[model samples]
Target: MLAKHSKNKKISDKAFITSGKAKLAISKYGKENVINATLGVLYNDLEEIYTFDIVDQEYRKLSSQDLYGYASSITGDENFKTSVKKIVLGENIESNFPNIYTDVISTPGGTGAIYNTFKNYIEYGDKVLLPNFMWSSYKLISGEAGGGYDCYSLFDSKNNFNLLSFEKKVLELSEIQKNLVIVINDPCQNPTGYTLTEDEWEKIMDILKRACKKTNIVLLNDIAYRDFDNKALEFKNIFKDIPENLLIIIAFSISKSFCSYGLRVGAQLALSSSHRVIEQFREASAYTCRGIWSNVSRAGMQMLSNIILNKNKYLELKIELDKSIKLLKRRSDIFINESKDIGLKILPYKSGFFITIPFKKGIDSKVSLELEKKNIFALVMEEGIRIAICSIPSHKFKGLASKIKEVLIEIE
Candidate 1:
């Protein structure tokens, strides 16, 4: 017999099995011949994993105390918290959100930030709202926190953020639950790369204003892929002067940004109108930290803090990140343009690590089998096929979109 909550647990995610299939295909064929695009991690044209030189150098320079000693606080080092805000809000922090009081609590990764928010805010048996196309982890995190999740249609007929459907779902959910947690993965959403325009953000806040009248709003903004965004810190201004009843949590991750995915450095950024609400967030989050992972990586926190606090290292890191962002954009351009040439329609992909192409639901298995037979591997989801542009080489991207279209045609 299993624990009551553990009885219904999933054995493994489809992505993992799909990836295993890709690896097996590579073994059967050859690495150079296979297009393994199942992972979200960045890779170079040579099919090697990418990491920042600065992060590697700094980590090696840290003392044993910095590496092995416990952090200054269970929440995190105070200076590390300050550095995270500076990096997130940008050098001109005053202009980002003059009215909102902010607080930070370090976590394992963006996953920890989102899970902590759900564990504290989500009531048992209630539900959080997510985009219909999202990282599968949101559902897992919600379940672990004793809650369920629903979704709003992510795109309209024209392939823009579906505000009407979003508002409808929010109102419908509010009617049933007193507290509502809506997860918005934007700038670069998972699987589907869609970014909301400034006007769209305004409309969402406006909807929340009305919805907040009926229920307490806990809006979790997952910005794990935000470093690739071309909009930069300009998007931070959207949260300024939000309603007091609405709490905003920014899921910040150093994993992708610093290539420290194994180190697991991340933080939960809380924004609200009332200072008291932020303080409550700090207390409740720290308690969760104590109960869960205890404390995050000291060396990882120290390294990130140092890079941000020092002018030279900060510039160096920024330069490196900017290069990766540009590289990702270029790869996306190749796929988007080639897909258009082949008449293969893609979802609205503003910027991100992955791009999605919609197809009939029942054709995924056949399409995936065909792709693997041709030594091409990609994530097959319910809505579409996900191409990890970050992991795929630019040269390889040139013809991938067409091949996928060909597969779809064959299967259909």
Candidate 2:
């Protein structure tokens, strides 16, 4: 009785479901007894959702019209577009690659930016290239676009970026498909917290430059957690001198950066050496935005533009964000050092919100369920159990690794 595409579609977000269970546990037992490391949102030591004060002040300054009015353009407000490029690309794109053509389109969240790219670029039955350990939504998004996906091994024997596997897969897919789409979640990548080094990016560019000769390439960089990494802008030097056939999309999110998770504001900034391609992107992306979701939150866009453009407000926002970064570092140190001491294995995590503990392929669900019985909630993935270091308080991180290790031992 349902339409073909709508029928037999199973949709359940494990992170939200697990987080719900964690909340129920907290209600049953005191907060001190439960560890809810399911969601990626920042939580203070007092177990409250943390918000940036500067963001709050600026948001309160917005006029009624700014809050309720439609965006100035389908591509987003002009100021929002300019501010996004400034914060994300900084001076790298403008100073280094003055000739590159760039355009920005506003979307609901980072997920919207990603989905828009997939819908416009991916042809039917084409597969996207992704990392072996990645946000599960990438696969779902691709499927919804009438396409599928394949993954390159994310790590190697030394627990580093698997450049060899990446090269092989990139070449293989480019040869098979007329247009290639690849997603790289970098500079505090989700789940695994792995950031690609500049050298690794240089190597990736070499591969892309070579592949672009055979097929048009789309590189989607989901930088939802970039604000948490101090070296984020430094690593973007690789964005320079990209081949004309390769288009780069930087997905920017206000959820983590502005601490405006509920506002759902984000943008897709498309960069290309070809003016014609970027022009096409601007038109296509705006059309998709109008069809799917007419316009993003105007209040969110106004708030971001105001803060980013004002020097004092921008400085205050940075100061507050630095504190959260320090807290994240402390939590990461405790868990990582303790994990090493107890001989618990975790994926290579440079900097980010989540840390993953890999296990036998089919045993992750059982492991997560067993941990839930102990009131420790983490997300179960195909490769591991994802522990949200961003949500866990630094004090709670002290003996947490050992407890999880014990459960892992018992389950295995």
Candidate 3:
């Protein structure tokens, strides 16, 4: 017999399923005939998943013990945590936040980091706040933690961050919930690829300060696509001088940045002005890790630490990653320009793996199904069709927007 929480659980990952269908079509019609933009992973010109050579080289250098041995602690290896902080925060953690205490705990991947945060911070039956258009897994993760979710309008009429809607939701939730957990996917958000401006971030911090007066808050900043945005770190300085009642948890992933998607290496970097709070976070998070996955990939963690700590290796990885980012940009540029030429309406995209094409509400599935008839596979969502620019090659992007427009017209 199934437990109460386990009953009635049905999960279907449309992205992977659509990707599978695209693969079948490619096998039948060839890659040139079908456009597979379902899965979000960087693909080379030859349509192969792109990975940094430096990662492979470093991984090969690890000893047998390094590859197979368990991590020293449930939290993860010391070197792994240090390297993650260096790469993500870009400074020595001690000096950078002398007054704010910090801690890092390794997780299976960015997914795990977010899951742990949800499980620990989100009270039973509580709801987390998310963007209206977001990665679909956030809702599933919250549900798994025995919590529900609400959303704030991601964009206003001006196609900018809707601070008014965001503040209203935060304050409203704070009034009811003892702890408010808010997830902000910034500097290249999923589905829409929109980034918040500096002014928006300042205003957001003000909102959090106001909300904190009513209830304790946990801000989960999911920067899974941070490495793709060349200017993402420009706004990192906003983390300083946070309130004691507020805790910021950054979900850092090695999967996207290092092109180690299957390696399952990620970490939770937590910041708080209170020492006791930081300690509690470390202990509770490590305990959760022991209960769930127990430990992450040792080889994956070692490879990342080796690459980030070594200057030459890190430089090489950066150069390779830059080329990948450029390729993604080229692909996205073609799609955006073609969409403009054909009068296809897409969301305001800055930089990221995905570009969302919004249509009439409740017709996203129909639109995507229509596109599937033409052998173009994309993830259907409540908001729109998400074109994974990272999966499609540069040359294949030509005329895609026009074809998608054709599908939209047919659906309507």
Candidate 4:
């Protein structure tokens, strides 16, 4: 007999299936003739998948042992864990976190970080709060952990972070569960490209601090697309002081940042003022790692560690990443400007891979099907059509926004 969770388990995600259709079209009509934007990966103007030269070259140069061997520890190699702390919290640790203790555990990627978080933090049959708009995997991860998930509205009428909604959900869930966990996918949130302002983040922290009096609060900051953010390390200062009952776990990823998606390297960073809390976190996260991936990739960890430890390589990587950011900005600008001209609405966007076109609750699937007939392939969700601007060339963005608008109106 199959386990209860295993019986009805199916891969219900549409992203890959849609991408497969796009791929067949690309083969039949050529990539130049097809507008394929179903996946989250980045592609250059030449229609080639992008892989950072700095990361690629460094990885290729790794010693055979590093490339073939396991990471030295279940958590990670020491250097990687240290560099990860620096990357997640920034170099000014003493100034930012004068009194807090922090811990890092390497995972297979940001996905693994979240998996561990959901597995460890959420109790069975308990519900975890997620944003209304997010990467689909959050729900799957929660389900895998035997926890239910609910979504809070991501934006208000003014199209700002819906803190009112967030607070209501936080309080409502705290009343129901002894331990509360909320996942905030931000800083270039997938499918929306939205980043929370420092003020919004401050308000969120304040809300959590107040909620902590009633129950333990765990805020999982999924920062997978953080390097594409508008500011560098500006959000780190918000962690200066924290309530003892509030646990902030940041999910760090190298997939999008280093163009090392296949390498599967990332870490979870736990920040708390209580030293004992950190020790407990270390044990739990490391134990979860052994059960799941055992250890992360030594070569990928070394690649990032090498880049972070050396100022020259770090600067070099930054320059290249800045170029990609600029390219993404230009692409979004083209689409955003054209969208405005055509009267199409997108959710608030600052930086990152995608732009979401909000539609009526049930029409997103219809709109997406129509778009497919026009040779445009995008990921369709319950609420909107997701345009992967990162995978499309800058020039291709022209007029496509208007075309989407036309399609929307025609269907209506």
Candidate 5:
């Protein structure tokens, strides 16, 4: 007799291996000296601003009973949860749009959130639509969910996600798949750092609405680096009027926003008009949560709650964050402008911590590895090198640009 659940047994490819550039940078530059333009981490000094006195004191005052109690059982302690909900949902709910629900469950990190959401919604043989160039986690999570579906390429010859091409793919997928989830990363996309313009978002949303009107589909908006853009709230506001027919889900993370990566706190907000549908979604998500990590880190939740509850402190923290974001933008502007001056080609990047540089001759990953010999670290994607700009110090921008130019010359 065949062993039960044998079909589900498979080798794990979900763990994201660190990029080669990251390892080289850490080894050569001693971690601190090397500019880490590889990960989506904010390097601004703002910890003091986010520090909370009241929360600390209150936390200390809590007895053993509080530690063991359910968060919802505390009748008067709803404000912490409410404040975080507001920040994550933004103007999407304030304008009478379908609001995002926060009580579904928690996860160790945003990746966990993605995995749980996929587990809850996807079934074997079901198809999930994704952009050709997306965060690698989407593929890993989707595979772990059930090993179903295929990715549709969204890139043009110029290596951009073209609207016309994307729409064509959606139309084709609609013909074959009844249950579909389309994932879109907006505002400082990981690995690419491409932020969609308001007009671009509008066009895509309109097309998705039209397509889903005739088919069963769900839209998952992964705003992992939403905080990197100064106008994150404004961009989120544009989604307020999305049609109710299209099932919408927003995955929000505090990792990049508050520089709380180690905390691993993230939330999934499901937007739907049907109470029954939302309820089922919540139940299924909770089940997945139990099966996986069995809920998020309690300490992480407390830290986030503390930061949100103290408004004055939060504003102070935002001010410091604003300063860091401005500095990051300055570094990005320097890199892009200097590269252009030297006749080097790069993608159009407005917001986000990364910039993509496409090689004219189409170099392979092995040749890209040679970049490490010059002390320039970068994540090599299929199209080009993705340089993380957030960690690059402002003073060193010019020197880094010059080195990259020299590398290009040598490679050519």
Candidate 6:
């Protein structure tokens, strides 16, 4: 039966089916017994141990009526709709996010939101542009949607987003394809943890604008970890004057931001020049959501709405989350700085949980396996290892770095 199902499906032959680093690390260390710094998971103050007194009571007081029911029913609830609108507009502008939207669809997770957004817009065989080094899911999801996806190489030794390479890809794609979608993740990028410089972002936006002027392009900005970095900036204002012909979709999630991984709550904001176009896209998106997960959890949506609605609660949560972010940053600094001090080459890490360390010539897999012997496991990406700095205690980072150094020396 499984063989028949596989034969019927049109799976992509070009797909890379290797297991991820997180799994390898877990396997080597044993799932229940690993000092895993391989996944970008927050590991502090996660419990609701401290009560907010009245706020706790208020949260408990909320009934089903108070929460937005379905995606289509969101606008009917005046208060819920208003809060969401405020979040999308610049009214309650936070550090990283600026533009807010009037209509937003709640989804099960960031991946769900991405799936729905792509399903709404992309047709079979349509091509989407993505950076080569992106979350592995982008290609998988695009292929599942029956869309042809292409990569704009970011193979620079500096590990930065190359504007010239991006432009060349965009121009080449425009010559061949009529419709394209470009995806970008900022702040703490996955795998490499590299962030774009302000100048690089400006050039990228310019390239996007120029490409959109010539051909139809959709900009899908996945701000999953937008709040991870203290130095992160808002670019919504910069995109305000973008061509009306272009469609911008923002995928937001609280999993990484609030450490609410199990909740699986996320929202998708679709921006377009035409209200009619937005409405049509939303209908398609809603259908896709219903087909996939039926509906998002009421409890998760209520928790997020409650926190955002109460200013004091929001501030308190922000402080707690900031503490965790700072801890992760400190750990990342120690690992990266120590590697540099010891004359070890590391991929440029600007603002993410991961730092990629390339192995000395011919020493990638051998070093990784040897570290496994020492109870140290990391995600090996291509010829490098992706260190999950956010997963380790700040005090443990130096010791871990030293272990990795020792392994590298042995392999060399």
Q: List lDDT for all candidates, in order.
A: 0.88, 0.90, 0.90, 0.88, 0.65, 0.67
lDDT of 6 by residue, 1-412 (tens): 5674256565532112212543565666665444455555655433112233333454467677644455334312234334444444436443333332225777767887788767766667887788766676787687667676888766576656777788999888877766677888776777678887788878887887888767877788787887677667655655565565577787777677756676677777777656665787678776777677877766556666677677887677667667767776787888878887877787778876778776645676687678667666566554667777766666656666677778887877
TM-score against native, each model = 0.97, 0.98, 0.98, 0.98, 0.82, 0.82
Which digits, one per residue and each the tens of the lDDT, describe model 2 over residues 297-380?
999999999989888888899999999999889999999999999999999998979999988887877887889988999898
Return the clash pairs for model 3, or none: none
| Model 4 worst lDDT run, 10 consecutive residues | 232-241
- Measured on C-alpha atoms, candidate 4 has an lDDT of 0.88
Clashes of each: 0, 0, 0, 0, 1, 4
Q: List candidate 5 segments past 4 Å from native.
A: 1-35, 44-81, 91-95, 98-104, 148-161, 233-237, 240-245, 360-362, 405-412
Which tens-of-lDDT digit does each residue in 344-378 have in candidate 3?
99999999899999877888778877898999999
Q: What count of clashes does model 1 give?
A: 0
lDDT of 3: 0.90
Itemize residue pairs with steric clashes in candidate 5: 37-388
TM-score comparison, 1 vs 4, better candidate: 4
Model 2 off-target regions past 4 Å? none
Ordered from best to worst lDDT, the candidate numbers read: 3, 2, 4, 1, 6, 5
User: What RMSD does each model have against the real structure?
Assistant: 1.4, 1.2, 1.1, 1.1, 4.5, 5.0
The candidate with the higher lDDT, 5 or 6, is: 6
